[model samples]
Target: MLSLLATLWLAAAPTKDAEPPVPRPPPPECLSSQGRTVCGYQCRSTGTHADCARTPYGVCQVLTGRVHCWDPPRVVIHHPPRSSARPECKESRGNVACGYNCRLSQGEVACNSTPYGVCSTHFGRLVCWDPPESVIHQYGARTPQPRCLNASEAVACGYDCKAQRAEVQCASTPDGVCRLDNQRFTCFDPPSLLHCDHSAPPPAD
Candidate 1:
């Protein structure tokens, strides 16, 4: 009787296979960016976009209209500029003007090397804006001005035909704008400058 009772007790005990573990959503700490406080089960930024996080649960979302999330925690969602293969400016409308023509849709724009005052496409070609006209129109009439500090600055600074890396660092100055790019830096009124290199490598000294 004693041996039989012991056997029955062993049979009643739980085994690993008898109960399956429940899958928990990723931990709050697992869903945050480095050095960021975990917001509910996710990580977020109060200023600019949060740097990419290593947590497997970290996700990036974009949309047409603003959205808020309450499940897990309260969060805001917004849209990002779509990627493009060509040179074009992001318009207020969620579309891109490709090669002097624009179509209102979510996608990339095809670009060419042509300089117009507003980085506009003319006919079916891309052109880089020449100085003065490039400076006056590309920025704005009252928005201060830009000056070239070097040959590279003069030629490489402006709306990049490819949004390439050249580096035109512009800062708001009392007179206008201060800028440094294409290996040069200059100060001007309103203190802004156009700097990008279509052929240069990514941002790094």
Candidate 2:
């Protein structure tokens, strides 16, 4: 048989992972609804007694004839402050522009549209460039940049290379070179440079 003092001591003993008891508010007045008397905070009333948790996910119950309540630790919430700076704007002749680093000059509005881009008016058209990008003009698009071939030594680059035994010749245009007679190592460019034999086999009828 356990003594009353031993029982009290056992009840007061701190167990492993024991949660701290929550302080409950006094029993609120019972409310009679649907022929039933509901008591305690949020229906946690136990036989003329009441117990409830103050924090989130808290619970209360009767254990060993005593109202016990436990609650998770209180949590604090932090929020970032709102920004007060307004958006940049530029207005011209009833027209409005909104963005960063806005500009209104010569009846035109320009903004720093792209990252690291400096916007400007080119021929009355707003143009932005920084990390370079391709821009095709409406009229007279820029001719593609010539891709010239480079070599350490002489690089004969063309489709007009004509070889004749000990002689090598080439023409400027692709369909320019006709025949490289096994005679002269001549490189022709159009206006009929070297005189050749005018004689030819008669056309067969």
Candidate 1 worst ten-residue window by lDDT: 72-81
Instruction: Give a tens-digit lDDT track for model 1, residues 77-157.
Output: 111012222222333345333221222323433322222212323333332322342233233323232222212222233
The best candidate in terms of TM-score:
2
- Per-residue C-alpha lDDT of model 2 across residues 160-196, encoded as one tens digit per residue: 5555443444444333453556565456444423332
For model 2, the stretches where C-alpha displacement exceeds 4 angstroms are: 1-87, 129-205
Backbone clash count, each prediction separately? 22, 0
- Residue 127 in model 1: lDDT: 28
The TM-score that candidate 2 achieves is 0.21
For all predicted structures, in order, the TM-scores are 0.19, 0.21
**Model 2, residue 94: C-alpha shift (Å):** 1.2
Instruction: Estimate the lDDT of model 1.
Output: 0.31
Candidate 2: worst-modelled 10 consecutive residues by lDDT: 72-81
